[model samples]
Target: MPRKKANETKTYVLDTNILLHEPLAFLSFQEHDVVVPMTVLEELDYIKDSKKDVARDARISIRSMEDVLHDATPEQMTEGVTLAGRGSGITAPSGKFSIFSDLELPEDHHVFTSNENDNRIINAALYLQEQKSPGQVVLVTKDINMRLKAKGAGLAHVEDYRTDQLISDIKYLSKGYHTFEGRFWERVKSVESRAEGRDTVHTIAKNILPEAYINEFILDESGEFAGLVESINEDSLEILDLGVERLMSRHAWGINPKNVPQAMALHALLDPHIDLVILTGPAGSGKTLLALAAALEMVVEKNMYDKIIVTRSTPEIAESIGFLPGTEEEKMAPWLAAITDSLEVLHKNDENVKGSMNYIMEKANIQFKSVNFMRGRSIQNAIVILDESQNLTASQLKTIITRCGEGTKLICSGNLAQIDSNYLSAVTSGLTYLVEKFKNFSGSATLNLDGVVRSRLADFAERHL
Candidate 1:
């Protein structure tokens, strides 16, 4: 509902991908007649053959459009939801250039597309604008640079194809690479800082800064605090220790993944009273395995919860994965390996446990679900583990967490720094988003796992590489 000048502009140009991304974008221009801008249609010609999912998704989209267009029929194509190309009987607006108006391409930025196509798309809008001056013609594209180009060409109006995105702002976070060299980092409960120096620091900053090394001693990865920020304080790092009884309890989970930090995280998570735990670690940290094991034990032996719920983002981009070469179980062998490996170790340590988790799997006592099916389901009295939680967007993460039912405890674990998609980075991922936003709330604790315990070689690769 953005308003532009009441000038004569009346036509909206749909970028080819806009239709493919949203698939239903064609009908969105109902308030005005939309121009596919002949050149935009041509762009689809090539994508029609792409070997990627986006390309396949594109094909499905174009076909859907065909129905809409055909259903409208030539009669309907002319005035509303019509199919006539620009310059047809509708009269080409002023300043409008012929289809795909020829233009010189800038060598640097124009390297990807044969400027032949992009320029024409731009010209289509320009042409419609000129002829229908004051008619309000604007270009809608998914490309950030493309939007900038439209502005540079004097077509100041443009918008993103928001089909795949939700508009909202979340604070950005930094991925600090600290070695935790004993002397430099001490886990404390609180710290204090003053206007001037001296340990007698008197101020009530309290444990306001939960992740700090000390109250007044703020430092970066280099162990110094004077570079970018100046805050006076004594902060606290609340630490909880779990003894062997708690470790051997029916609900206990000893993480085998090679990260020493899980030892601390396991302690925090084992406390039945603390219902929510967030674990963030690098790729091999074993966050998922630990959560899964805890969930299994809590269900099987402790009778702590009715079942174990596991979920992760679909990683829509990684889908083909090709069917596994084994039986249905074997096909998912690779994906299930992580979960099973964790279970194997859990059983190894606790002789009281026996058999394949097949009983749980067959009975659906332990549910392995994709993030796609989690909508609107209220999960209760269960131990829920949201694996690869970093891959989730802030809103998606919030949605997943809100699904937890009463007596349900949810654990979100993933390395914010290890995201596989460009749409979101460490600073903006849901994992870090949760850490920054929910840090101080009681009954909620987060443990940053460092020290790769995967193996001598694994540790070496993690630290050196």
Candidate 2:
């Protein structure tokens, strides 16, 4: 085998899951040779015909691979086709791509079953290692078990595909709220306070402030004070008084704030200036309930928007029911059960006012939509609630957010710890991504509800189980 220099090209063997996780992952390895194990291709073929997001990604990966190999001859492909200029808008790199149809396994390798696809892929990587110099062949996978198996097979290098991970650790994710120490109200009132219409705006010294972002919730260390950051500069900071009294008294539809975080969420939800709001917390934390209540209040009572659009991503809970029957709304009812339950709660005490749950739903003008059909449509002057957003990928989040037109307010609520998508983790979830990306934006806010108000049993389970 020929030994390459320190700056020489390296080969990355991609797992099928990596390509499914990111369709364009091949373009990320700049100036490195990429190998597609034939077994990986076989797995992709098996999954390409499904109606799931993974299937769509597999199709896209197949197309990208085809486009890259369009002009390469069979001999050239075997000899490693140059990947330079193959990716759209990507700068050409001195790398190559080839399909590893051959397999080579060590004589003593016995950790993995020979019939398993994962083992076959690992064996392909082992063959590449044998063909290339030591430390030049690396196996890239998102599956932890597969990486462990590769290491057990005596491979030199194995790593997780981290190109799409925005945050490396879950602990560092933004909590959307911060607490200040040392007489917070005294410090805030001492600088400057003025009434801007019904809201009071307060200015604070730059030195006393913690690293705050626009619209981020600011609370006193005692948990009695709450305010929203209006603006900030190097010299000073301005925060709009959240008026805790007003928040506590404010009733959306029929729901009231049950906790401090819920109060902050309601304030952000009803604020006319804020266009985006994200609520993240544990289950039974009143995230979806608060968002729905506020959305109804805005659309029905205040007439701030035309209607309410409710959508969510449905990654199968256990086993998929498969190809639901009926109209769009009917087919989506199972997934929209949460919205329906919230509606029932909102209308529970409104028997005299609305008389029927269907009437109240109609009066609210709520529309249930699936996340799949949201592309290429512009949602204007509507409150779009994306529940269970933790199941969405970053690319899917971008598509949904971009669909928001003028006068549209988007509210995304999800429990990051309850994510169902295998491709998404707490740090890489769409909800977390939005929190990190929109933390500094003036028209956006986030709330992480800590209180679980569902019931004593639910709270106990959340804490213990």
Candidate 3:
């Protein structure tokens, strides 16, 4: 246990959403006294038996909490139990874990009523603030409104749980590329060229683009040059030259690039050497369309992979999926409609559109799956298209990414602006985490499709709205 200093150790009261967002969140506070409000426990108990996706997380959180406090006596439960040897790194095993019973707060003592769970949690924080006296008491939650209410009710310290947030602002996130104004050669004082098969590799000074990473694209205003950063050394870098004309003419299952960003995205998606491709952009930037096209081409035309697996997270997937009677694919159809829509767009000009769609579906062996059922499966030799990835947390994405076995390629695509999860933001999203973490990996590539090519209205809305 960490040595306690007078009035320096804080008591952090955790809300239910924090545990739901991350099952082991309680262990993150180092050397601090962690308190779980009784109201939060009740909410977890109620949600544990439900069919929601978070039900499993609730069970895990309960198990983790019980494992820490199971042997504690009734009096010890009210006091804090030592959290030593339970966690590591950002998770401090030196903290004290306890449960706070806010329901016993008298009417005169309570600042907020115990009728609602949020209010009750707030009252618990207020109670701790008074009880702890000179020490600090903070309400840590992912809910914005709850934080506001806690502060309004006279709780001095309130903070959003930010252990998983890798970046503070979305603008600091990598766009997978760097653009040099005018000619890129003008800045390059010297270079060494070599031919490796059909591709030409160029060695240049690292100062030319010191911030470049592996598989990152390099472009210029003149539109004459485009290169991929293949390797980075101590004082220099190696780039694989990909001419602009060649990138623009690249095709994937009859879909052509409409812009340079799209061209680079298609290039990354088509490369068999790249195992993971992350696409991020605004709505109507063709993230899904490009991913689907590349998957179809690689699976059907190129015969690179045996099948295509498509999955995404939906709010109602867990609760409504089981109640809606059908096979796994049929039950997942509603959520995977975006994939089918892209297939139609790909084969729209065929003689028989439905026949072509059915033929391609069979030929490629496309499978629609739910994020809820992706656990404990070793997937191999397939192209996995994970759409709407911005809504996923880093741990949730890790669960799916680790399932990819040998010869598997995972394409993660999402719009950071369209995050639907209450606890997630553009910078804290799993997509952002994946891009930043894998940018240095040689087998991964990221592309930020810049334009809204769906229609004129989409372009205008993306800019103005």
Candidate 4:
């Protein structure tokens, strides 16, 4: 393959994982040719009717391709068809979208003699590289091994599918709080403090914390100052003073904060003013426990919401769940054991732990729901806890978040390091996307619970493993 010039158009060969990662991935290659190999389509076809969670995505990808090529004849399909873009909101590609029949590729042109699907896809890209000589051909896949194989097989341009990746590195991701070196007040030259009903509001110059956004927490190394960014202006910021002692003393359904991070997470979770609270951290960091405790406090004690809906997505949890024998909640019980374990810990001291757990589960009206069943419904006056959200795609998160109607609050908790999806990384996780996108939203708050309060052993494992 030749190097692609800035003004020249190159052909992009998309692997099945790319389409599954983003159904409209073809349209994402703006103004560039996209070629879908027959083997890729065959893989999609095989996955579409399966019990896997990505089956819907495969079907959507197939429908999108059909919408564009249904009327085109075989000759035009092989040659290429113009992408309409339609209602996709993406700019129509100036180049063409075509399908290639890898099965018909001559054995003489084969890069690998194996009939494996990956080899077939690589062979297709190699064939295109040969046929489109002098024109750059890139294989876009999410599989790192696949890219290595393609490169080793002599394909010049191989890249990861990163069209949806927001940040180049995870270190740049927001931790929801900024800690100053010494005392935060010592560096401040000017400050304006006033009483707002029952709370004190301080107006400080924006340059002090230039990147501060609404509801972002601000702290100092002195361990005495803690404030939340209430509002931001071009020149200044309005910070709501949250005394560190008060923040540490906050509790949710008898669950007290074990550290400053947990305290901040609990404060965000219990805030009725904030509609969306996202929690990210390592395993054993109390992400799920805090979220669940807060949900119970709001739903059962404060009556802030009518019900608590718990949902999480893992490849095993989302697939073949219908075959389980029981009600929806029962079917989800095994997958949502973390939530139940938290419930048990919350009521472990009761006279009858089992009875207390049952009573609280009923009293709170907590419902365990599948992500698949959560779509196409208006969730009103409820608290939705989406656990293990790092495994989800941006589109998948959008589907669930958009379902929240009026009076609904969503608490998304996930460990970016523990993403189970093959196509997702810490940088590409939907949880990361939500945190970055909603950081400035006044009604949303994000927190990274850095401490592992689950156990001392868990903390050691989190650090070493």
Models 1 onward score TM values of 0.53, 0.88, 0.95, 0.95
Q: What does candidate 3's lDDT look like per residue over 1-465, in tens digits?
A: 675685898999999999998999998888888999899999999999987878889999999999988899989999889998876676456878998888888887778754899998888888789888999999999888898898888999999888777788989888988889999999999999999999999999999998889999999999899999999999999999999999999999999999999999999999999999999999899999999999999999999999999999877435458766799898888888888999999999999999999999999999998888898999999999999999988878999999999999999999999988888778778898888889999999999998999999999989998
lDDT of 2 by residue, 385-408 (tens): 999999887777988999999999
Candidate 4 per-residue lDDT over residues 1-465, each given as its tens digit:
575563378899999999998998998887789999999999999999987778999999999999999999999999999875443555656578999999999989898998999999999999899888888899999998899999999999999888778899999999999999999999899999999898999999999999898999999999999999998889999999998998999999899999999999899999889999999999889998889999999998899999999998847645668788899889888889999999988998899999999999899999999998887999999999999999888989999999999999999999999888777889988999999999989999999988888899999999997
Give the per-residue Cα lDDT of candidate 2 at 306: 91
| Model 1 regions more than 4 Å off | 1-251, 254-260, 317-334, 349-356, 359-364
> What C-alpha lDDT values do all the predictions have?
0.57, 0.82, 0.91, 0.91
Location of the lowest summed lDDT over 10 successive residues in candidate 4: 84-93
Whole-model lDDT, candidate 4? 0.91
Writing each residue's lDDT as its tens digit, candidate 1 over 1-465 gives 575454643567777767655555655543355667656656676777864334644676567566556656454553445333423343432221112222432343332354466666776667667767767777888666777877887785787654333223322232221233333324333444443432222333335344442111222344322111123235423212222233233235444333224544665566576678888777666676677766765676678788777666645653433443544334444554666676676557554444545554544386666565576899989888777788766656777888987898888888766676534555546677777666545556676666665567877887888
Q: Tell me the deviation in Å of residue 225 in model 3.
A: 2.0
Give the poorly placed runs of model 2, Cα more than 4 Å off: 1-9, 79-94, 102-113, 185-190, 317-322, 352-355
Candidate 4: residue pairs that collide: none
Those runs of model 4 whose alpha carbons end farther than 4 Å from true positions after fitting are: 1-7, 84-92
Worst 10-residue lDDT window for candidate 1 reads 93-102
